[model samples]
Target: MPAEERGKGPIVTSTYRVQLTPEFGFGELSELTGYLRRLGVGGLYLSPTLQAVAGSQHGYDVTDHSRVRAEFGGVDGLRKLAGQGFRIVADIVPNHMTVPVPESGNAQLWSVLRLGPESPYAAWFDLTFPVALPVLGENPEFTVDGDVLRYWDHEFPLRPGTSALPLDELLEAQHYRLVPWTEPPGYRRFFDVSSLIGIRVEDNEVFEATHRVTLDLIDEGVIDGLRVDHPDGLADPRGYLRRLRAFTDVPVWVEKIVIGHERLPADWPCEGTTGYEALNAITRLFVDPAGADKLIQTFTQRTGVSADYGAVRYEAKKHVLSLFFKGEVDRLESALGEPGLHDAVVEMLAAMPVYRAYVNPGEPPSAEAVRIVETAAAEAGRRTDPGAVARVAHQVLYGPAEAVTRFQQTCGPVMAKGVEDTALYRWFPLACLNEVGGEPDHFAVTPEEFHAFCAVMTPTTMTTLSTHDTKRSEDVRARLAVLSELPDVWADAVESWSGQVRFDPALDYLAWQSLMAAWPIDVDRFTNYLLKAAREAKTSISWIKPDPVYEAGLRDFCRKAVEVCGFSVASFTAVVDRYARVNSLGQKVVQLLMPGIPDIYQGNETTDFSLVDPDNRRPVDYAFRRALLDNPDDDTWDGQKLQTVTACLRVRTRFSADEPYFPIEAGRNAIAFARGDKAVAVATRLPAALERRGGFGGDTVMLPPGRWRCLLTGAEHTGRVPLAHLLSRFPVAVLEGS
Candidate 1:
């Protein structure tokens, strides 16, 4: 298939991402069709709807692939929603399948356990039997039933002729071994999540079976597009995409993370990434590089953390590998058949700049892949054995097939766990800059760089500001960006707050930042966020390593901070309130009006002060939003945001994403651009700095000659417009040409 035809699917004008859970499923979504239509969304970008473990909140842990989840109103409810005329962009998990608590919840996995290697479904998953399941506790006891082996409410299938034997003898006869709960499993898993077992989707048979229901939905026109979750986790991402494209050409977007100046491979048969690149790019425009030094210095001074992010990240990766990825390292080390290469392999994996190297078996590695291997090896060599680095690097590119494939697969999860989960929490110079697939050390992007990024965006590629995975919501980051301008004031406030109610010095700075960033948050929300932060940082406590006394102190610290320092934090927020609002509105307008099919993550149409999962996935009070829309109030921030989003979406239809983009020469405080001949987007960047410099002050953006009306405020203009006038009411101005 031609690469141009690879990702082509239904034309999605705009999307509203709905987190589908038992609380909100297809039936619930069906009820919101009228509201969604009014919200200017053309498609429902849904979370995974495949049948997963019963009562699963996020459906990424899919137990079966052949059926739409009955809990999510099943296939009938989905078809009924499709009848509403909105495109359905389904989020699909192709990398792994869930191993539910009952163990029998996934029939194929159960059958495999019962029948061993002779099971017809043996090829479906990547397993190395006797499969080592980590379900045993210390001093574990077992009981036997008619055809099952039981251990404290957990059951396993008994092999034929093994049910009549002694418990110990029966265990020996079984196809799988049970180990202590803390031990890593012997089978391939999605990251360190042993329950979410990795599937061999690279196999054609596996692909057919796994994607059958989704494909059937596509054929039936019930599904219009696909958002492939965690493509980097797949063994042959490029090959898997090619096979998927062969089957159907719906706008297939991979949840691929691209780092600094790295473009998604043009040859890959899919649409671009699900838009961390765009998210970072949008964030960069608002972040002032000038403030990086002050912020870094302030952060270091306050928390005693090193200023170097790369070093901090490298250490974090090494720590994460030792803690969570020892099983993967051991597997690769065993595959290499080379002695004493374990440390070198770990170092290289830790040193990897991107998620993974695209070194598929038989086919030669891409230049990008080779570069990544060489770069990581070079860096790894600095700390470990250079000879080992050379040997491992060679093996990665030209060694055993199993070694090469496993090495590639392992890098992504290692990076994700080490960086996104660990390093991001550890390094806190400017929390706004610390996003997925982004370097916080690299503080900001110039307007020219942002424009260059915007110029090449794929029309149908997804663009978004916030997602379920973001460290903070779009508005939260927007609010935090104001710190770049007022770093001195922020530093003083933290010092004063610390004096009043202090925690661990290493984490106190971050806690204060979070408190102010997500202001109006109560005790429970604030304490829960801090606890997660403490665990993710793995400083004094971690998810695996529980410290009861330390955690209690952490909780008490949060309470004290909120109760004693809440008033002070609120006062500081009030000071930067206007500027933060400007940034919040500005970035929203820019992201929505820019190229690509923008997604409005639930409740982000107004303002969502969320932090990470479960928090970000909190129930959106749509009734409140609906009421606000019913009675529009420009006087309020939420109302202003609603007005901005609706305006951008309204005029977004007039501008073709692939059309010629003309960059308008506005002053440095503002970014201005025209999308084709139809719409012009102008947003205030660095509002605090702009204010410091006596405002727009004769700064003008040359508009196209002819009548143009501001879509946001309904103001009329005929040519060059002053920045102050164009953005009088709001910080962003979207003008539609007459």
Candidate 2:
């Protein structure tokens, strides 16, 4: 087998991502392998399959890593898949584990609790010694009610053997100090999730202990490679990557989110990131940059809010610190021991562009990290105290390494909650541009920029359009991108709709627009999305203190909004579908044939118009997709999308890693590129613009001198053919050298 086929280089064939749960575990996956193979998928990229918090749908909150969860069909199922010749890329959460209750199945964590510092597993977790960890109420008040220790509404049940022990004695025996769930935990956690405690994986013993099962899988040939989840949360991301590389020669990709112009650390020994940047890039290519100003105007007119994402993000981050993470801020303030430092620290964290800087223990912080902090501090200093700003910046830039590490750890959750969770929903400048790690302010990615990014990272990057974590599905976002092209029509339609019904105008604008994109959308899905969106926005109702009145009002408004907007939804979907048909096929062809390795999210090959989590992670209809693949005559949009994806993947397998990439200039309405002599991809980026130009306006795409045939339709074309002729059969074209 070639190195690429062995998961050493780019995953030349595509990877299909599956969200595994008890509801849809290894048995279902095992059953789907032949279908996946038929669809040309090279590997199965699975969600965390380890034993987790009981009944958790997403497996990130792992309770134990020693073995697969029984609910997921365990070792037998894994071997079955491996026996069938499917490559497996497993997601590993090295940063944290589920904080197990005493009776839970996690032996290591339970052992630490029972044996204190003397436990062999004591070094596995990060804990503050001799301090009572806050696990319940603000005050250390607990009542032993039989086997359960109750604090307010919370309960920590003792194990069967420990039921006879007194509550104080039980508490004293634990290595960790449990306190009320507060911010800036005495012990580190995975963001604000108290139940998922951070581990000391940087410790060699801990690394060996936690990764034993996974390494065994790799050695046994059941697992081909690893996907590192949230390496930014670790104390040393670089060190961890080095350690991960040492254990296996199999390919590894980190779940790192690189912000605007932020490059991945060249030194980290991994394949590349899990492709949010690529997702953002491909999605934005289809958006019309010409409509940015008009959409901004329409957004402000309809919603009465500024398109200033930075300001909104800053305020939202501040809200997170004050409202949700008070304990964390308190911890930072205590660490600093200086007046007015908390405010400055929050400002600096809010301004951080990337997730966290990997500052080695002995070295000064990287120039990039220092620049980000100093710049944020300087900007904040103009409004606050210079002395305070300097002190905070100094502490971050030149302080003890652990303090910096703590702040870096704190930044991850703040960004995830405040930016991705809150501000993304609140700021609806253009919902297409609103994605995790996306900069809404950046607007669009030019061909030059997209190609440059590919040049640097394509060989190892995991290119994707949608994932389980995306805010919206690719097709939904594709429809929303239509609004950017037809701002006048969108604004007029929204204005007319707003006059018919009354709700939160900001949310109304958001809901109505999204509803149009996801039309043929049902009431239950719409209602669930609105509730989650409202809570995430934290405007009228929040997760902490939900306003029942406002929620009822929002719910009623959504039902009526759907009723009122039916005609508009029909009309918008008609127009948007035309554009989406082109965009969906375009993105599929481009992503699969682009420079990087492409990953197909389950069901996304069809029309996956899901909204967000729970919705996005729903079960895939393999029978439907399989039937579509089996019979290629149905020309529906879903069938067309699957056909386009399969065709591109087929052509992609012929590509060699040695091929030099050449960007083809195909005018403003399209983006085209070539791989050596044998393969080329051309996708329509702005169909609306093409309509305005009456089709391609004599724009010519340079081919490699001779005849090439479309891989999907077998339409042949010669050198410098008119754009219209090249894309006459399909909106996107993937051609092979004849």
Candidate 3:
């Protein structure tokens, strides 16, 4: 397996995370190749390109596995991109498939519905026997038409002839049992999503069926690598990876969430994680740890929320289980064979430090994971059902693979829904620290930790600052990091503006902070993001049943936030702009020069201040970016952002995987490191601290003790110098051996 032949090579991947809908499909993406190439991108890491549920913006809800998305120009478009010599890394959803209402497009699911247990495809999905797929309200009396099964307002298309039977008989004849959407049915699904059913990809037949097109694309040279989405949801991720590796020898990266201090399982066959850990490490290094108390104070005063992240996480998990995943909890309890053990299980899951432990049957569970479970159970104050605990321990440690698999799958979604989606919006400590797989409680990443992480994991890691699912863009986060510098100014702005408008205290605090970070925001983007943010917080309103009165209040607040507070907005923007420039260039330099295959999210070359989802996925203005790239004299902050990225990436191409990484002894206000003897990245971490300390008056950063040319300014420097001299030209200095 030569590096290129095995799809394992040094890559500077650019992530195209938006879906290929009719408006922006393959044709649209194909136009960016030359621009990407010129930007120094080595490959395109694409979103799920397979067929998905109709009109899905992000292709995670894949409905078909055997072909490329029809709207995205299918295989030909992929070949076209690859034909241009750009390596393609495709995202594959092996854990689940969409279960649309009509059941018309999915042949296998429809067959199972029509033929019950006798259908050959019945074994493909993770359904308990005498199968019941919940499609209608609980115990509803239904009427039937020619081919429609009607339950109240909903009419579902059953198999043509089966509709002729009474609704009850028709339901009984189907392999899946249709229950209310609210019911946590026995079947495994992707998280608590009722419409996305989990596939038994651990089954040899299922794996083959689901991965047919993916394997073909690899064989045909259209795709050079694989990114396995939500491997935590799979029954046997390790086994599946092994099978996938055997099936195709291409490099693979799992979308595995490694929490604080946890590493990816050593035994799994893959390149590395999709890089949330690295994202956490790099981003938090830029955040000021001293601001944690003030932010928590503001959060507490307004929202009346506690500062304890763990308690909030535990309660949020409980809330999700009770309100949303009641049936799933019930099922897990049943599997444990003890009714009282429900809370205990939920407690253990909520306390799980990492996404999951890689424990195989007949093998011991990781001691650390065992300790986490035991501690959570004790702290939950529920007397352990010894027998039930033993049963669960057996499943987690030994056989009954399905039980353990479901348990593992359950932990990730609970953590995601409880923490990232819910608690992150609630906690206003720092929006940047509340990223995916990041711990808000842990305010900063120490230099020692960052160095150690890069030493071992950087070789195969996929480091990124922004991604499609990020709560905020990298630059947006960069701007927000500046808020830590002037906590008093930030607190004053929040207090003064918040006095004029009435909104949910906590939500308002969060909104104002976010608005400051992305100041001069438009009405539409602000309103939409606020609405989504409020719903995700779920304190006052929710996604399923939004509170109209609360939503109206939010809209008013958003309007006032932009229209009424011009002075405060101007003041904050000025401060943010100054610090944002430093943060932006520093991050760009470090990310590109860091010890990993760095990925630049589209449109992030400039100072992107976009928020999560639809906001982050908005169409890129390539023309504007290209114009900036072409105009060397354009000294705007966006140009600086682009220049820093370009210079480091070009310098990066010269370094090999075996390049030596030495951490530099830059002062506390800055971080500098050398990549071998050639590349030195000196990034300013705390601009506020430096300004207070009188601009590195006596501080010095020892160079490689030889002549080095500044990559950005082309200035020459030798040996030690006032750190001010090194960073006077740019907030960050990227230098190479002269």
Q: Candidate 3 lDDT, tens digit per residue, 1-738? A: 224546545443434343456567777888877877777777778889999877878888787888899888888887887788788888899988987756666777777666656779888887775555566654578777776666665455565467667656877765456766556666778877877888989889989988999899888988988889999888778889999989888778888888877888778888787877888888888888788788778778877889897778777777776666766666666766545777567666666666777665556777875775555545544545555555555555454655666677777778778887887887767778889998887877666667776778646567788888889888888888887777777888778888877577778777877787776688789999999998888888877667788888788888887888756777878877888789888877877777767778888888898898898888888899989889755778998888888887778777764478888888788888888887898988878877887788888888986788887888998899678888887888989986
Best by TM-score: 1
* Whole-model lDDT values for every prediction: 0.87, 0.79, 0.77
| Candidate with the greatest lDDT versus the true structure | 1
- The ten-residue window of minimal lDDT in model 3 covers 10-19
Task: Order the candidates by lDDT, highest first.
Answer: 1, 2, 3
**177-226 per-residue lDDT for model 1 (tens digits):** 99987888878899889889999998889899999999999989899889
| Cα error of candidate 2 at position 710, Å | 0.9
Give the range where candidate 1 is weakest over 10 consecutive residues by summed lDDT.
1-10
After superposing candidate 1 on the true structure, give the runs of residues whose Cα lies further than 4 Å from its correct spot.
1-10
Pick out the ten consecutive residues of candidate 2 with the lowest summed lDDT: 130-139
Backbone clash numbers for all candidates listed: 0, 11, 8
Candidate 3 pairs with clashing backbones: 132-177, 133-176, 133-177, 133-178, 134-178, 134-179, 135-178, 135-179
lDDT of 2 by residue, 461-486 (tens): 68888988999999998888877788
